[model samples]
Each structure stands twice: as structure tokens, then as C-alpha cells.
Target chain A: MPEVLKIKNLHQTFEQGTVNENRVLRGIDLNLEAGDFVTIIGSNGAGKSTLLNSIAGTLPIQEGQIILKGTDITKLPVTKRAKNISRVFQDPKMGTAVRLTVEENLALAMKRGQHRRFRPGVKSQDRKFFKKQLAQLNLNLENRLETEIGLLSGGQRQAITLLMATLQRPDLILLDEHTAALDPQTSITVMQLTEKLISEQHLTAFMVTHNMEDAIRYGNRLIMLHQGRVEIDLAGEDKQNLTVPKLMELFQKHVGSGLEDDTILLA
Target chain B: MAIGVYLTFRILDLADMTAEGSFPLGGAVATMCIIKGINPILATIAAFIGGLIAGLVTGILNTKLRIPSLLAGIITMTGLYSITSRVMQNAANVSLLGKKTVFTIAQNWGLSRNNAVIAMGLIIALLVIMLLVVFFKTEIGLAMRATGDNPQMSAANGIKTQGMKILGYMISNGCIALSGGLLAQNNGFADLNSGVGTLVIGLASIIIAEVLIRNLSIGGRLLTLVVGAIIYRLILALVFQMNVEPSDAKLASALVLVVCLTLPNFHLPRNLKGGKQNARSTKD
Candidate 1:
């Protein structure tokens, strides 16, 4: 039960002191232990994305702390935190370089967190390794090593991106609605690939989703956020038999009021 | 110099206007160094360093100071005018009529003046191309390329995108300045006014190369830059022989670029790969 990630009293405010002053995260805390796959769902503007951004270091933490594997990373920039934290963004285009070849992108991932050097970018040996990894995707991308990633379909790009995130076995992986941009069938494909990869590596992961079924169907735990705070947390046996209606019941029982956003329930 | 333009304009996806300033800066530094009795080889190296500094300044402005890339380049180009003048001893022109240069030194080795210029030019160009080919194949170089294509992905993957950009600017401007230094010697003098219209010529050369070839390997693409420059020069020579106004040379270059850039949109047979049709100017 050793903590892999810990957030304490995290607070985020946008446009402080301006007329449009707003608070996205208000004194929130979270803890994740080894191999804990947590799927988070919340209403629109309930700080789901803001929380993920804060953890990923894209948005600066205004207060409190984020510690990963015993180091205080609250002040580390995105690039610096990237050694341990890998991310698959909502936009598939954001996950990979467009003009780089498939093997070149994979080579970049192979050297993640390592110092860049003057050595050849894609060594012959590495190409074979990349091909082997690509073959596992079952997407026939292994034969297209020299093809530019931009030429690939969005699903293929996302698959490659997911592979890249796990290439070096990151301490944690963050999925910020990574499959939200894909078509329904492609999203299912990517989601399955995600589950397989995370389970295979026993990876500790944090995911944000807007769909309640997705929030319940995937991951080892589920969290519901309301008003920048964790309203309900479920895990193990409590989460195993959960359905959309049961989850809704849990939300109402916990919050003492109906959920603010029915669009999430309908989704 | 066109390769330098390619690095920023094509590879980095930033139209860096600093090439105009750095080119003449290289000329000014090298000319002054040669006049001070420095070896021609050392003078050219000094020019390269000068360009690197100018590129570094622009990179800092764009990355650290958060200036737009285009604006940062223009700022550097405008500011370098006074610096170039100062380097030329407060004069707008510095003559190297009787001074030593790489070309003159090559002539001292029992070659004719034209032969010396040709040999020296080929050697320097080959050396630059080889170095760039090797560097771009390296891990650091690949990362730099990725930084240009997608900064967000680069940062997510643990790359310091800003550092890569600064490095690209240095290399691009370094080549440009080195070319400036050599051109000053070849043209027999360095003039502060030489920077004007330099970017347009470089862009024209690059566009010509694109029109001539499609989907080549990185090394092959770099080689075509040399061929493209030669062809562009030949075209200019033909234009001059046609008795058109020599002062309108810039106009011709602009027209050639415009045609090549838009020709793809006209659905020409240039797409040898049978792949997706790509408009030349819209790669960005």
C-alpha cells in the first residue's frame, strides 16, 4: 500500500483578483498506491481536467503539494516531471510528432528521461525492437517504420502514442480523455489496448472520463468529483458490480442532492 | 545559406528573418578578421561564431522573452545593422580587394583564381553538408526535429523544447553567416546593404528545390539545396541575358517563388510518389 502519488491540499485559482476570478480546484487531496488504476468522472467544469493538468504539471500548482515516489514534484515543470509521468492527451495529434517516421517516434520514446546524445537516432538493432513492439499492436504498423506518423489514421496514431507511453515503464500514466476524440469503435479499440497495456505492466494510472459507463467499466477504482472535491470513492468489491444507475445512486447519497450535470448521466 | 533557411523556414516551421542580419554580420566579422591579418580559415570560423551569437539572441528573445518568432528575428535583424556597421569600423562597406580570403589562399596553392574559388566553394559546401547530415541523423538532432513538428509531444516526452529551438537557431544562423563570410570574399567586399532581399533569394532557392523533387530522404534533400541554388542562379543569368532590367532581379525571384509554391495547387505532375497531393506552400 505504499503511495506512488500523493496530493495534499491542492488549490488552483484562475484570474485571481480579476472580475472573472474563478477557482477550479479548491483544497482537494488524493492518494494513489502502486498499481491503482483510478478512473475519475465529474460534471463539466468540476475540475477533472484541471486536476489532471495540475498533476501533469502543465498547469502550475498554486498551493499544497504533489509528491511522486517520495520526491516533491509540485514545482517541477512538465518536461522535468516527464521522467516518471507519461501522458496521453485528449487530442491524438498531441500525442505524437506528425512529421517524424514511425520508428523515429518510437526511438524517441525508447530514450525517454535519458540524456539526448549524438548517437544515431534509429539504430538497426532498435528498428527490429520497434518492429517487434509495433507488431504487438496488431495494427500492421510494424511494416511501416519509415512512414511519417502524420500519414497514419488517428486511431493508429493513438495506438502508437499509447505504446510510447508504456515503452519505458513510467511510474504513472495519465490519460486525459485520450479516447474522447476517436470514433466510437476506435475508442473501444484504444480502450482495450489501454487496459491490456496497463494490466500487463501493473501500471499505476489516472484517467479522466466524462462517460459514466466508461468510468465504471474500466479501472480498479472509480471516483466522482463534484465542485472541485471528491464526492465519492469506490474500490474493490464495492466497484465490481457497479452500474450507471448504482453509481448515480451513490452520487446522490453522497452529495445529498441531485447531480448538477445530467449530460454526464445521459452519456 | 538556403539550407539555413530550410532549417528555420521548413524544419523549425518558423520564418526566421534573422538570416538577413546574421549573414552580413558574418561578412563583417570575417572581413575585419582578414584585414587584421588573421588566416582566412580562422576568419570564416569567426563568421560562423558570429552568426551563432546572433541566432542565440533571437532564440532567447523568442523562447525566454516570449516574443513571436517572426518578430524576434526582425528585432535581431534590425538591431544587428548598427553592430555590423561597428564591426566594419563605422563604415557601411569594407573592401577586401587586396586582402587574403579562403579563395585567395587556395589560389596561392598553384591554382587559378576561378579554379581556387570553385575548389574552395565545393570543399566548404561539401564539408557543411556532410556535417549537417551526420548531426541530423543523431539522437539530439532527431529530438530537435520533433520539437519543431510538435512541441507539446516533445515536452510530454521529456524534451526541453526551448533548448532544442535555440540549438536549431544557432545551427541555421551559423551556416548562413559562414556563407555570408565566403560570399563577401567572392564578391570582393562586404556591404551593410547586402542583407536586403537575402531572405527572398533563399526562400526562392528552397521553393525551387521543392518543385524539383518530392519525398526524398533527408540527405538527398540536403544535396538538392545545392542543385537548387545552381539552377536558380542559372535562371537569373538567363533572365539577365534576355536584356530585362538587372535591377528587377528581386522581382523575378519573387515571381519564381510564387509560381513554384502555387504550382502544386494547380495539380501538376510533380507528385512522383502517387501519394496524397500536398500544396507546396501549405506544409505548415
Candidate 2:
């Protein structure tokens, strides 16, 4: 598969050139191929979200280039990057407008990158298409299209958000702990839905998760980050054969820290 | 009936100072036109236009200068006192006294002056409410509402949040100006210090309407606000009727607002499981 996303010598720092300046990322190099599912695992403030944000163009990178599908979008603005890359934020509510109806939110999402005018009417055909898409989630949201998103449960809204993010078939989908707000069962459901959407659409995806088991289980490749650098980059049969015990052993050997945290190890 | 009008005015959330100036300004303009041998209907139109201008100024100050909405309104209102006085030709007060007011014109057309004022107010309110309702249903309107609720989200969605903010202030101030114009005409004079403590009255009206209408639907909520404004005015009228000194009127208005601010804190029984009532109480 062709490389869909490439990050070359990426560097990012928070509060740069001040007494409180802290370097978050240092000389990070990474690449993602088409239809690749990669899970990122890191401890707190490990620059995982920052990396994703950099790629999504939410945060401006301090140094280095981001090449998406053979195009350099390093200095592009957030609105411009939105056309090629979509994001599901850690907070479920961040991704969608809570006050708006689900259908209205979806309509806005569909119109992303398209010039919108005061059309005064919504076509029946567009409604039918939206219904068909919502039906695929099997969350009974197809019937609740007119209901305000604020009334929906966090998990349901996240599902709807995920659906909306992928509606345009963006070149890359960034899942920044998208299921973190959900209950365990709902989280599992959303994760399954995400995996299905990624595989079926053949879309390149990067999912950041604190859960070690999910990181090892969900994706074809698992990348572990320590102190702003990639500590482990396992793939294919090696990634599949890697057990939780072996992963813990590798973390101790590589990062000089045991994977003992309940939040990280429990998953 | 008086309570209903007062409550409706409160719900409209206009801050009421515009009404103080605009109501009297409307009266001054209408009565002046009537004295000039102009048609009563046309005089009323002129009054409404005067109110619109007042609202426009307030909106511009708040939106363009990044001034706080309340401060911007207060400034506009203070400035309007002198402007209205000048418009009335340096007269501290303009009185219809014996001239044909819009009310008298309606009376000549076989309607009572009181009935005419009520009809005119309702007609203008209805037109405004309809336009707002339709606008809120449109894309731009949605963007505007979102800007009011969460400006950051609107900006992220590529909506011009600044423009929407300006538009909201303009619409709000415009309604207030119109109400003021109506009040002035009804009373037959524009008093220089008319808009004093207008904000409190508007807030009181808003609170009362929210208390009456429990639903969260945007249209329902907006209608409730109008109802609140009317109720707030009626309460003031009733207080005046109860032998309260005219000098203590501002004090009475302040007390009404204090009660309104406190009323939501009074515990009410929850009717539904996971009802908003419980949520609201907790928030308070």
C-alpha cells in the first residue's frame, strides 16, 4: 500500500522561549500507509494528542513537514486541513454540535468544504441519503434524526460523530481517544463500529488509546511512545504474536519504566 | 392582565432602558407629527423608526467595539437622552397634551386609544417574532444562535461569529427602541430620563416568562420571553396603582428583578424521571 501520511522530523514545544518552556515532541518521524490501522499508546503528556493535532492541523508544528497523500499541508489552516483529514476528539461532545438536531449536524458535516448558500429548502433525496447512512449505525438514530444531539447519550453521539467524520471519506481519520467518554460496553460497541468503518472504507486511521489491550488488539500495527519518541513500532505477524506480558517486558527494557498503572495496564 | 404584559416584556430580555427613551421618543415624535398636521398612522411609523435607530446604535457599539452588551446598552441609552431631547428641540419633555396621538387616530377610526395601542404593539411584536422565528430556522440564523450559545463552535464551523454577534445586538436593541417609541406615544410625552433601569425590567420579564413556560424548545422559549416582558410591565403598572410614590418607581422595578432572580431557587416537585427541574435546582 502507498504511504498516505508521512511526518518527517516533527518537533513541537509548548510555551517556547520562556522560563516555563517545555518540549513535548523531539525529532519524531512516522509514516502511515493506505488502509493502515495504527494504535498509539503513551503515558500522560506523552505528546500523543499533540502529534494527532499536528497532523489534523489543529496545532501548528514548530518544525518539520506533514505530507498527506503526496501533498505538503504543513502550514495549512485548520479549516483547509478539514477537507483532507477528519478528527474525533477525546470529548464526545467536542466533535458535534449538541444543540442542533442529528440530521442538521449531519447536513452541516456533509456540506463541509462545499460552498453553502441560502437555499431555503432541503431536498427529500438528501434526507433519504442521510437516513440510509444513519441506518448503518444500528443505533436507532435513523428514526431520531430530528431529535437534538444534546438529548442523546454520549456513546450514541460519539457514534453519530464518527459516522459524520467519515461521511466525506477523508484521506485520514484521526481518533483521539474517541471512546474515552463512553461506558465500557458502549466503548466496545463504538470501537467495533470504528474498526468496521476503517476496514470497509479502506481509510487510513490513527487511534490514540491509553488502553494497552486495545492498542495490542485492534490495529495491525502498535506504536508505543516514551518521552516524545517512538519506543516500539511493531507490525504484521510480530504485532499479532506479541502478548501483553511480552509488551510489558519490552516497555521495561526500552523505557526504564514498568507498565504498572491501572489505567494503562488494565485495558 | 397587567402581570401578563409585565412578564412578557421581561421574557423579551431587552434590558428596558431603550423603552424608557424610545417609548417617550415615540410619543414625542408621533405627537409632534400630529401637531404638524401629519396622519396619526404615519406618526406611529415615525416613532417606530426612531426606536429602530436607537437599537441600531446600541447594536453597533456592542458588536463593533467589543464592548460588553450591558455597558454598550447603557452608553447608548445615556447618549439617547440628549439625542431625544435635541430631537424634541431641547425640551426636557414633549407632550401630546391636546394633539391627535396615534391612539386618538385609531379612536377616530372607530377604535379606543387603549385598544389601538394594544393592537399596534401586538402587530409589531407579531411581525418581529415571525421574522425571528423564520430567521432562526435558516442556516444563517442557526449560525447566529450558535454564536450566542457558543461562539467558538460557530467560528470553527467557518461562521463569521463577529457578524452574528453584531446582528444579535442590533435585533435586540431594535425591538427595545420600538417598544420605547410605543410607550412615549401612549403616554403623550418623552421624558428625558425615560430609559433609567430599563435593563432590570427586561431581565425581570425574561425570568417570569421562563418560570411560566417550562419547555426548552427555542420557539416556545422565545414566546415565553415576550410574555415575560409584558408581565414585567404589568407588575410595574400594578405597583404604581397601589399608591406607591412615582419617585419610588425605580426602587419597585429593582425589587421585582430581585424576586425574579430568586424565584427559580424555590424548590418545585419533579414530575418526570431525570427531569430538567431537578437539574436546574442542582445548578442553582
Model 2 bad stretches (over 4 Å): A1-8, A57-61, A65-77, A121-124, A257-267, B1-109, B150-156, B184-192, B269-284
DockQ score, prediction 2: 0.24
The TM-score measured for candidate 1 stands at 0.93
Candidates in order: C-alpha RMSD to true structure: 2.6, 5.1
lDDT of 1 by residue, B141-239 (tens): 889988888888898899899999999999999999999999999988998988987788788788778777867767777888888888888877877
Candidate 1 Cα outliers beyond 4 Å, as residue runs? A256-260, A264-266, B105-116, B269-284
Q: Tell me, by TM-score, which candidate is best.
A: 1
Docking class of 2: acceptable
Candidate 1: deviation at residue A68, Å? 0.9
Clashing pairs for model 1 are: none
Residue-level lDDT of model 1, residues A19-89, one tens digit each, is 99888888888899999999999888889999999998999889999999999999999999999999998
Interface DockQ of each model: 0.60, 0.24
Each model's fraction of native contacts: 0.84, 0.09
Q: Which ten residues in a row have the lowest lDDT in candidate 2 chain A?
A: A113-122
